[model samples]
Target: MNRRETRDAVVHFGPDADWVREAAAESSAVAAADGVASYDEPEADAGAADAAGARLAVCELSPDAGVEALAAVRDALPTVPVLAVVADADAVDDALAAGAADVLVRRDGVDDTALLARRMEGVAATPAESRLGAESTAQLLDAIDDSFYALDADGAIRRWNDSFSRLTGYEDEELAGMDALELFAGADRERIAGAIETVVETGSATAKAELVARDGETTPVEFTGALVTDADGSPSGIVGIGRSLTERREREARLARLRQAVETIVDRAPLTLFEVEADGTVSTVRGETLPERLGRRVSEGDAAEGVFADQPEMRRHVAAALDGEPAHGLVEVGDSTLEAWLQPALDETGRVTRAVGLALDVTEREERAVMLDQIQASAGEVIWISTPGKESMDFVSDAYEDVWGRAPETLRSDPMSFVEAIHPDDRERVEAALTEQREDPDAYEETYRVVRPDGEVRWVHDQSSGVYEDGELTRIVGIATDITVRRRRERELRLKNRAVETAPVGVAIHETAESAGPITYVNEAFASVTGYDGDAVAGEGLSALAGDDTDSDRLHAVASAVKTGDRGSATLVLYRADGTPFWGRVDVAPVVDGDGEATHAVSFVQDVTESKEHEQEIERHLTEFGEVLAEDLGVPLREARDRLDAATDDDPDADLRRAEESVERAVSLVEDLATVHSFSVEPRRLSESMRGSSPAPAGRDE
Candidate 1:
């Protein structure tokens, strides 16, 4: 037959036994090739076998009888490529092992016998070159890194590469005739077997399994299997390739562990942590148990579009972060406040893919800050904090209005404004003190002046401490107290002391000791009288000025009396520094204490030297005057007495008459002189004695 006619001469083997009817229609124009006569059943099988050396047989096995029937068919026609037709694809593997060259799984609306005959013709026409070419292809596959295997229809291994042996830890001798199911680990055996059956039935399957090696080590593997078709275009067996997934699975497990560890840390932290996706969908909320509002999932629409949302500022910040800008702010969440920080998630191209949020609960800190502000507002002193520049104040307390006569907000704008309010005279001193305090933080005190709005000046005492960050001065925080009243009181006391220092008179002060002794404090007058400077006897005992002849007992008694609030006077001999003596009357009085105790003594002394001399002169004058008066009387009376003696003895009469005039005159003159002398002498003597005796011993009533 010609090439084209020969294609038509090959009868597609589907019509039951109507060969004559087909041949009569074709005529002899295309002669049919002499081949085989076919029969449908066992009764005509002998004739069909006699006509052609080989008999075409079609067999269908029940799901249970499939394997046994295939085996019997293989013994009957060992050389024929039996095309076994099966209802299910699962029987294809057993059929191929029983010497069936190909298999066809029945599908709806398909002529199986005709389809098989066409496929056979196409196979027969192909040269042996294709088979040899397939051998070379298998060799190339063996060179790859992956394990490859082909199982026969009997579920037995047909061919495999060296990689299979290496991967399974099996030698060629042990694996050549073994069942492929033996390579599966116990956990994967049933799964692998089921996959093989699926591939046989469906012509393709895929499975991942843990496979066991000859040494009992397990490795994760992925298997991709396909049915190997025969000449009749029917499934004959399964060919599978395995790839070791050990490294891939290990990577996945490590990633899982890392994620778990991160979650654990975030959950245990006191601060909140969260993640936002590209669309602003929040996920992965973790922290100390927080309010439900914080834990709720937030979407872009919820943040950007919703009204009555409390965290509008936070939402704006997060939106900015998604746009590749970082933002941080304070916001109030459900039941707590937080300081929220938003960062951008970057992709490989350095573009922001999403935003991640990290929130810290700062509720307690905010509350404390508010309370501190209230306390500062109520303080009586001005409180402030300054930066290292010393040129500005960041925070100033409200009490600045009372202490510095300026609003706290004014100082906050310009810290130097407070400095300008200082009194010009005190400005330099205040600056020096502040500079010194800054240099040595331990020197924390400063005094300065502040001029009020009413033009009154006030003294301010500032106590401060340096705040250091990284060994650099960051700020100075301190308080300023108004000390103007205290300073005024101090000035008044100084003026009063000056008045007491210059007082007149020899006023000496004695300090009473705990042991009832006395120490002297002499003023300038006391120093002049004692011929010693005030410093010379400052701490000396009061008795140090007395001489050995001085009446010590009387002096002690006077001191004791004076200490008990009784005034005393004494005519005592005082010893000078040169060991000379002087008699003077001294008066002592108590310096009473607050509790009415005589804790000190004060003595006022005056010199009586001139007065004592005047008294002595007066006494001598009186004595001379008395003597002259007696003598004059005696002389005058002698004349009168001689005349009066003759009259009183004879002069009582004649001397009374002639001497009566002389005698009377003599008596009158004598009486006048006597009276004058007596008056002068008596007054002078009494005055001198009284001046000397006015002082008595201590404790005496005078």
Candidate 2:
């Protein structure tokens, strides 16, 4: 390898010539030792390069503008390759935009002399036909890749180069009087026309357009022109270069797409993008959720070997990248699963030099996928995802088979097939609603009936939402639930409510029993029977209805059992709102929950006043009759007993025994009559006996 071939010395000019000299010396020593691209300095006193012959000009420019200094250097050594040096990275752009052939920041290239020298060599290596201050304008224009042309003030072409001829497919004779604007078509033509007009009026102009050729094919070109003037300062024509922007635009579009994809992942998922050198040193680390040693932030230039000490797999990925092979897969990092892709970056020599790694934190996405699997197995909801504007369904969960009674694959193939499952009565309405939602896709809610393949109708409650970015819909997610059972229960509840309202018996529904809450609801019959409207009876328990004549002990027992979620019934003297006492029969039943713990109580109340009063009257008459009989028969029974005793002889004759038997039988008849009247027992006492207790079956009985 001929690494040493003597050329010309690279001139160094700046405030820091010593710094330039030091870097130059290192490169110069290597070049001189091997006799390669070398630069000889002018005498120390001269403070300048041989202007007409210097291979390259290394000029240091002011960090602020550097415009004046750059102009002066270019003016003196017009043909030399000028590499501008700026203080910071930002100034590099300014210098380059200000007509610099190349630029290097002081901090980046100053310490790396060989790198700087190589950059200088590269600029110097440019063909003289492509460089500024070429020996002949015709030679330079012909050598340029861009189409060059000079046109008159009226847009008529005056002069042109081979590139222009090749670009437009027109010979000199054909282009002799053609208008410059005619070289373009469509919007490109109009824009170039405006740009040409601007150049004629404003002295200089730059614009991008497509130049049309004789064959109708167009090439994207960036046209930059300067107005040429005659001696009297009158615009004569315009000299311009039409640089083809095809490659540049294509490259930019590719980069934009790549950036968009990466940015989208970074926005939604936690991720880390990194670059590692061939020696296992991390050059850059950005984004999120990448595990670090002891929770430290990953820094640039950190040795990958140390940072990933415990991760042998990660080390292998980096090694693979360095070995010119790409690796990608799912990797667990702490509690998250990261989808990693490692791609190798190579130099011009095709040797793998670096590894670009992307670790997308797919933890939530993976978990959601797992949750969808579980939902498919047991959940009643069918999940679906559609493309933007719902043009197509991207994915439909397996649960679709359960809810929609159609295969998931069927729906995926034809997104609108779910409409077929909808009941005919609702299909048109659902479709209309969906059409209306397209313009405004947010929280869309709907409930309709679906007719399954088996002809079973299922009530479905479907809801969907659109995922938007920058006010543009990007995706639509939907869930449809099989709510048939819930709908059935609701219908049953409504019917039962109507029945309870219309029933003849008064009904009171207590919300809770063990906790002892007030009645939550009561049928109209209750208000009519008790003479207490719902408002008047608010917060009042059944025991509150007890009047003075009410069986207090029995009422307490019934009230106590109802509160503790026990079933009980009793007819008690209760008062209405008008201070009227009535015999009310109350029967309560406990409502227990799934666990058999009583939650509420339902009581059926009936007015038993008429029957109760009649019973009382019967008991009163029986008592009076018993008193009268006792008054009339008490002395006779005693007198008979004495006579029988007097008539009886111990072992007397048969006539004496017959008389004694007659007297005893009459006494027994009177005794039986006396006890028969005393048999009228109270209804309250009977209830107590039924409960197996005499005193209201005690123990917190209230």
Candidate 3:
């Protein structure tokens, strides 16, 4: 047996039991070899176990003495490890049932003393392990929130608590009997091993290192270890408590980010920081040269009182802060406005210790607000603001009363009443816009008519947008503009357009350009006169109307005048849709904008074909009349000359008189021919009369 001496072990036996002394002496020799100084007590009774410095008890029971002696020893030294030495094998069961750590039998082939010593050494290890295996140790380990593990001297994991499994993701089956150092990596493994060694060598040690989990992820952990000892005060193993640092590190990082943000704000903003003591005194004052205000009570007479004079409720805020509530308010100090926020400082026990206050200069903000109010008053449009989805107006400028002709107070009291005032035809559209604004809260724009209390209808162009806080719609601000004049002009234009469309004269409007402008629109009359549809000529140049007999020069003149934004006329024969030609007059004028730029050209076309035919007839009639007159005068002259030649010898007065008569007769006939009723007589009779022959009478001429 490999053994060394340890503490003395108590042996309880009868006076006749001398073999125990021999066994004790041999066991001491074995224990001493194992580095334990063991002393054997042979005559010690069960009651004297503590006096003997007993680490374990060896009970001797004779076969006839029964197991009663072993039971008695067990009852006396219940905590001490016991080995029952029995000569009869049958008594082994009884000795074990009496709470013996083991049973040693004295047999013939076995060296009884050596066998008893070996069994005693086995029992020596039992007392300490038995105490640890008690329910209380497990309860104590499991009660802790942090992880715990026990490792043997060989660095093998022996026991682990529930938290160990949760933290490292290693169940009992996976971690049992594995090397505990395998849970770490790189220098962390070496460091943790060294820490465990230090704990074993000394009493305890603490270390911080990273530990690996099942998925090969490492977590920083704080480890505290202490050496575990047996009842004999010999080092056994290490029991360590390990706490994960993940949440702690995350919390620290979050706090660092918040501090950085606050620092950035403080650096950029004009602010004063003050610390208020629990007794309502300002202990520290920073920023804005307020050093003299420190250690002063925040009351009526203090320097801070002037700053908070406008905010009388500040006293209640301070009281609330001291009672563990946060507060904030705005106040005016001198000519400057300041916004103040106060937070309670809490101690470990959650009691309010003090208050930290930050005050920011808001003078610029106040000035801007005042400037906005002035802008609203000076603006011509109606300026209004309201809470989103609420039927009440928060603010409306003076223009509201002028535009809607209703008192602002009434609209403010019932905002929906404004919707009721909307023209019935436009009310549904306006309500729909309001609903859409409430749902999406984006910029809203709509033009609708409103009916005033005076029964005058006015058109309003409303444009609005939502105010948001944290991505939620909070309020709506908008402007309403009167577009009534523009709408009235539009109506007048529509009526004018209708009149032009149905006019008697053919009207065609053309686009104005540097060259011949394109025809854009043609009235129904123009279509009827041309036999060509509007679509055929629209976008076509004015030359599209010219055909075979069209007077190109006159058409060019008209087109040039229209393109140059002037009025011009052209009388030319234009071809009809069926290839027939007729005389037409085209009058073109330019349409110009306020900038005097010609945007369009309008032309009026008149068909003067009948008048032109009548003029041709008149010219023909005049030509015929001249031919008739010439013939009548020529015959008279001929006859008169013949009479003069034949009667040369006769009286000259007589021949002259004859010529005079012919001349007078020709004059009379010309006069009668010139009469309006001359065309009613026969053309031959007129010819005969002009021949200087008497009328043959109507029947004879026929």
Candidate 4:
């Protein structure tokens, strides 16, 4: 019997006690291993539990013995783990709320005794061994949920709870005696040390820092610390809880960016931002004296309708927006004209929460015919003039025919016919954009697909500015340019980048001359091979990746290729971040522009250590064979040749015959050696790669 197994258990009786009995029976086989003792209901009180060695408390939850029964069991064994068997759904929550350590819903009839034994083993030791009654310090510390750490007076971590261990990615053994300040860095460590000093002077203090983990990952954390006082009233140590501030910091950054964007539009531009309640109350308003220019006297927290009391059209637009649908209108009050766009803000359940809107003043518009009467269109440009509100076209440029593949007469005849050239999917959005531009000309910049008469769709980027004379606005001038080729190039570049990013071999792109310049990009494979993350190496020079001991010849070869605007390759030893060396064949290709001059260079690296070692082994074996061939056969052949050369006229035939036989023997030896080496074996590979967009090596596995 081990200490982890239950020695004593308490079971509380209720009307549905049969469920508890069934569970206990299913687990009785293992429960009997330690000569387990049991105390039924009201008999073994919490005070008597210590003497009885009670380690686990079991109870059945029902209307008869629900919260009240569970509370009594908790009081009897405060620190002991309580396993509650629940028959209905309602009692599960009730048992948990009453401090049950674990609740087992009546599912699958409690068929597995091994699982029950596992849960029992997970509980703490008996109160006499661990704490005064049944109180478990580990459980109490973990109950904090947030990271809990204890630091000594010297700022070294003396103790930490499970939460702190998990959050910091450190094991219990690794955390002991670790400097608490080491978990943070730089200015943060100094600030945290100051905060600890503050805690010693005061009662409590709070500070924030980025908590760096075992693997160098940092988490933004807010820590609250308090001083622990000894009997002499002197500071002994400090204890603190660290709460993660990652989400809060991210949300704050996002909100700050949004506020900056909104302020830029409402403050710098001639626009007013407003939010109103259902009861016609203005809750928010922002702008640069736009309200004053529009003769609006009401401020935020005032009645919204009173802001436009002199203009009934604007008042109706606000009311219509609050009711259900979006509304917009133009109001002419005194000498200025105003355009307002209002829509209801919907909640998660699609309920209308409030009405928000932007108002623009457009009283100084100029006549379009007078502004564009003398301007001429340039190449690839479509300069057009229309009515003050774009109700009809007054003039169209020749470039319109070149880009839209139709004459300008059609648009002049029917101003709305411009929609016919827009792609079907984009026609609605384009129409809405045009309508918005007609209402407020400053909002006219757009990019949309324009379909020609010949069925070729082209992308058009158009921008326009309003023309005004004196104080009355009258015209809108626009320029539309064809951007189909640029769009195609951008899309193709993206696909090429994707192909490069997923290439198998390590790949790096530099500004120019290999790594002589700054490194621009590296894919995941590069990071895997080098053990240096992209963020760590990008924008750094080659010195960051290679040391003085690394091969300079191969690197110089790649640089020479870049200088000559040619592709080149060389074999070299490359080192990972841990200084593990591998034989690498690096191929560098220059990226050229239209002038055929290199603007950038891409380097592809493959580990060739295995294949290079194999080739070396083959060469070594061949060298040994050559030496053996000379020692075993070279003398005999040489003697035969000398005997033939020294033969007299009469005996020359004999010597000649002997030399011929030796020659035949040499021929046989050569043939035999050729046969032995005839079997073809494919060379081993460094890597096998799929067909990629760029140049890459194909190597089979060793």
Report every candidate's CA lDDT: 0.64, 0.71, 0.70, 0.68
All candidates' TM-scores? 0.40, 0.54, 0.46, 0.37
Expressed as tens digits, the lDDT of each residue in 499-618 for candidate 3 is 988999889888886466878888889887776678988777667778866789999999887788889999887766766565679998889899988888999988776565456546
- At residue 23, what lDDT does model 2 achieve? 56
Model 1, span 362-417: residue lDDT tens:
88999999898888867788878887556888888888898777788787777778
Q: Residue 678 in candidate 2 has what lDDT?
A: 62
Whole-model lDDT for model 2 versus the true structure?
A: 0.71
Best by TM-score: 2
Stretches of candidate 4 exceeding 4 Å from the true structure: 1-377, 469-472, 513-515, 541-549, 563-566, 620-702
Q: Which 10 consecutive positions of candidate 2 have the poorest summed lDDT? A: 37-46
The C-alpha local distance difference test score for the whole of candidate 4 amounts to 0.68
In the range 285-393, model 2's lDDT, one tens digit per residue, is 5565344421457666778887676667788888888899999887666776777789999899998889999877678999998987787677668888887556689
Clashing pairs in 4: 46-76, 364-472, 364-473, 365-472, 365-473, 365-474, 366-473, 366-474, 366-475, 685-700
Looking at model 1, which ten-residue stretch has the lowest summed lDDT?
A: 1-10
Report how far off residue 396 is in candidate 2 (Å). 3.5
Order by TM-score, highest first: 2, 3, 1, 4
